[model samples]
Target chain A: MNMHKYEKWWMLFGSGTLLIFLIVVGVSAFYMGSTPPYCATTLDPENVREHDSFQELGLKQLDDNEYSLTILASAFDYDVGNPEKVIEIPKGASVSIYATTTDVIHGFEIAGTNANMMLEPGYVSTNRYTFKNAGEYTLLCNEYCGVGHHLMAATIKVVE
Target chain B: MSKVEQREQTTDPHEDVDLKGTLFGVAIVGFFILFSWFGVWALFLSR
Candidate 1:
């Protein structure tokens, strides 16, 4: 076959680029444990209010600089347990957010942050994020549950 | 010119075409894809 030199080089370049992309994603998925959002942990939605963690939906210190924030997404509100719809934490603190819905599926997304999950009625979705900067981040529900979905939001205040 | 002389003087059209411009354009596109991919990848890893 008579192939031009430029065509041969172009094929190499294109194939090489694709190979690198596949290797990167493959390594991250298989070894580093980076994966897409999914539903694995589950519980009884009917009795969620009585569950150990669900009993108190708020932030709890787990370690020196680590914390766990339990949240319940109802019809159109997120109960972070606190009267104020805000989660205040020190900068650089690692917070594991466990979110679950009481009625329908809702999107748990923290604006400007990578903390996003899908909260299902009987399934528990969780995400961990360390707030490195001091700012007030918005927590909006990306999923439309009902007429009040637009009003569903929370606040994540990271203080330095 | 004679028919045989004219036929021999004709050159291959493809041989005269310069691929440098196409190469440069493709190189730009490839780098753009790579840089944007890294930007997203870095964001995902950093957060």
Candidate 2:
């Protein structure tokens, strides 16, 4: 087949670009520890509130700069426990967040950060993230649950 | 001019294109793709 030199060059360029993209994605996801949220654990929606973690839904410090945050989503609110109105964590601290919904499916998204998960009624979703900067980040539900979906928001205060 | 000569002259078979311009356009698009892919990777790794 007769082909123009420019066309051949363009084809090579396109293939090379695609290969580079695949390589970068594979390396980042596997080697660099960049992965999607995963939680195989499940619980009854009626008994989520009775669970140990859901009973005390808030941030708890673990050993060596690690923390665990539990959140329960129901209706249009995120129950992040008491005493702390806003989710507060120190900068550069690794945080693992576990969330479950009692009413319907909701989206757990933290603005300006990579913390996002889908909260199902009967399943627990977990995501781990590190707060590298000190700022106030907004947490919102991306999925539409009800008329109060727009009001489903919370604040995350990352302090130094 | 002869009929054959005039016919050949009038038949514009191949179109001329600027090689530099074509390659420049390809390079721009390739750079954009590379930049976007790297940006996504940076965001993922930083999280």
In order, candidate lDDTs are 0.86, 0.85
**Which sections of candidate 2 miss by over 4 Å?**
B1-32, B43-47
- lDDT, candidate 2, A1-160, per-residue tens: 4455677888898998888778877987898877789878989899898887687788999978999999898878988886344988999999999999998999999997889989988889999999999999988999999999998888899999
- Candidate 1 lDDT over A1-160, as tens digits, reads 4455676777888999899999999999999877666667889998889888788788889999999999999989999888789988899998888889889989999888888888889988877778988999988999889999999999989999
Candidate 2 — which pairs collide? Answer: none
**Residues B1-47, model 2: lDDT tens digits:** 66765444553333355566887898898888879878886876675
Please, what are the lDDT tens digits per residue for candidate 1 over residues B1-47?
A: 66765355454565567887887888889889988998999988877
TM-scores of the candidates are 0.79, 0.81
TM-score of 1: 0.79
TM-score of chain B of 1: 0.66
lDDT of 2 at A77: 91
In terms of lDDT, the best-performing candidate is 1
